[model samples]
Target: MPPQSEVEPYAAIRRDARSGMSGRALERKYNVGRRTVVKAIASAWPQPRKKPPPRPSKLDPFKPVIDEILRKDLDAPRKQRNTVKRIFARLIDEHSMSDVS
Candidate 1:
């Protein structure tokens, strides 16, 4: 997000543009981006998009290996159900993968 110091000028720019101010003149007067001036002329309200959070799990990098192990376990005996610990262990044993916590 940009500082209010910068964002605060948008309203004034939009106001000027709304009253028949040209995009080029708005750009020159406000010293904002050309796109910003154009958007200001098009609409009075600003709608800045909020970014979603990133999701990275320790298990993410090893999804294929985990999926294969779990798929194979589906055919195994009832007593051989795969657990989180077992999955981690199998990953360690088979892939020499030790990056996970």
Candidate 2:
């Protein structure tokens, strides 16, 4: 993936080229491909990334209980806060949640 830093410069070069410079001049000035300069001039902003909706998790059935456990932990000391293993243990031991291995 192109970093946002790189994208920012492409937009700048595109703007500079649009101001008066030729395509070849912009390519030489920015040390980039002609196609890349064309792409830069086409859009100033990074295109929004499309992400798929989340699939349901194996732990979805127990999310409410997990939320309660995490909420309670907020008032506890940092060292005493529950880790994932601790939460898993608590879920299995207290709620008789089984099937996870």
- Choose the strongest candidate by lDDT: 2
Per-candidate alpha-carbon RMSD to the true structure: 7.3, 7.0
Best by TM-score: 1
**lDDT digits (tens) for residues 23-94 of candidate 1:** 888888888789887676566667677898987887777899889888998999989889989888888988
Off by over 4 Å in 1: 1-46, 52-58
User: Can you give the lDDT of residue 65 in candidate 1?
Assistant: 85
What digit string (tens of lDDT, one per residue) describes model 2 on residues 30-92? Answer: 888888788788878656668999987778889999999999999999999999999999899
- Candidate 1 clashes between residue pairs 3 or more apart in a chain or in different chains: none
Report the lDDT of model 2 for residue 28.
88
Please give the range of 10 consecutive residues that has the lowest summed lDDT in model 2: 2-11
lDDT of 2 at 100: 73
Q: Quote each prediction's TM-score.
A: 0.45, 0.43
In candidate 1, position 9 carries an lDDT of: 75
